[model samples]
Target: MATANTAPNPAQDTLALVGRILIAYLFIPAGIGKLMGFGGTVGYITSAGLPMPEVAAAIAIIVELGLGIALLLGFKTRWTAIVMAIFTVATALFFHKYWSAPEAMKMMQQINFNKNIAIAGGLLALAAFGPGRFSIDKR
Candidate 1:
């Protein structure tokens, strides 16, 4: 009887590592920005007219920083990726929607929205593929 190969594939490992690093790289800045109060993220959230801007900002910062670190460490990668994906989508819809913006600002809004969408796709990929053998989740 022929035995099926159970060895881990190098290419899959490479892809997972790349995905983890890439997603982590993208989120770290946003997380740090929130933590450092750069670019007025909290103020910007308030200006967006959300009911509780402080709470919203805090949640965003926590999720981005906390979940991002978890992802980079490859701990609970799939759950963290899924949470980040949802957060990304919500951020795009709430802050980056261009339709309500002044004509002059519409282009920038659209760009931001598109960028978040792209990031969300990467997170989703991580959720599906996991962090592989190079990660903390390795079997």
Candidate 2:
């Protein structure tokens, strides 16, 4: 019978660190952008045809910024990651779908939307597996 004496794999530890960093880094700029209202984020939300655009903008900013901070600090990582994953999906569908974009911009919009979906998938994985021992949860 195999005993539980397996040595820790440094490669996996490194990969986990990379994954944590990648996922965490992606949210930082987005959160900052929403918090600072950079690139006319509020106006863009209004242009996206959502009802009560300002309210939507505020909610988005709060969720993105708040959850992002939680994720960065590794606090409540599972819940934060799940919330971020859902937010990413919704944002991709509502904001990046680009149904009305011109031909030249359609490709870029599609790529951007798909990229968000991929990011959401990564967040979901993190939510399921957690941030490992290096995180606040430490599960």
Candidate 3:
């Protein structure tokens, strides 16, 4: 029988570190922007037909900042990534329903929807694979 290599790979570790950092970069600023524009975020959410827009906006800020920071530090990596994956998908569904967009906005909405899905896929990968040697999770 052939045995699979069950060893640490430096390249894989480095790549995981880079991926985590990049994802964090994407989210942290978004959280900060939402925090700074709380009223706008609430207005946007209301426009999307969601109830309690203020509450939704608050939850989004918390999740984005909390999970984004945790992912940046590689803390509770697996669960954090999983939660992020869920959050990404939910936002994509609620906020970027490109199929319903008016023609002119369809293309942009479609692109945003696809990007959110792709990010969720990446988060799922992080959940499947540990945060790697460079992470606080490793310590």
- The TM-scores of all predictions, comma-separated, are 0.87, 0.82, 0.94
lDDT (Cα, tens digit) per residue for candidate 2, span 46-70: 7888898777777777777777767
Output the number of the TM-score-best candidate: 3
Residue-level error in angstroms, candidate 2, position 27 = 1.7
lDDT of 3 by residue, 1-139 (tens): 1125675588888888999999999999999999999999999999999999999999899879889999988999999999999999999999999999999999999999999999999999999887888999998
Clashing pairs in 1: none
lDDT of each: 0.85, 0.76, 0.92
CA lDDT of 36 in candidate 1? 94
- Name the regions of candidate 1 deviating beyond 4 angstroms: 1-8
Candidate 2's C-alpha lDDT?
0.76
Candidate 3 stretches greater than 4 Å from native = 1-5
Query: How far does residue 81 in candidate 3 sit from its true spot (Å)?
Result: 0.6
* lDDT of each residue in 1-139, candidate 1, tens digit only: 1125564488777778888888888787788889898348768987888877878988898788889888888989999999999999999999997988899999999999999999999899889767777888885
Give the clashing residue pairs of candidate 2, or none: none
Count of backbone collisions within predicted model 2: 0
Q: Which pairs of residues collide in model 3?
A: none
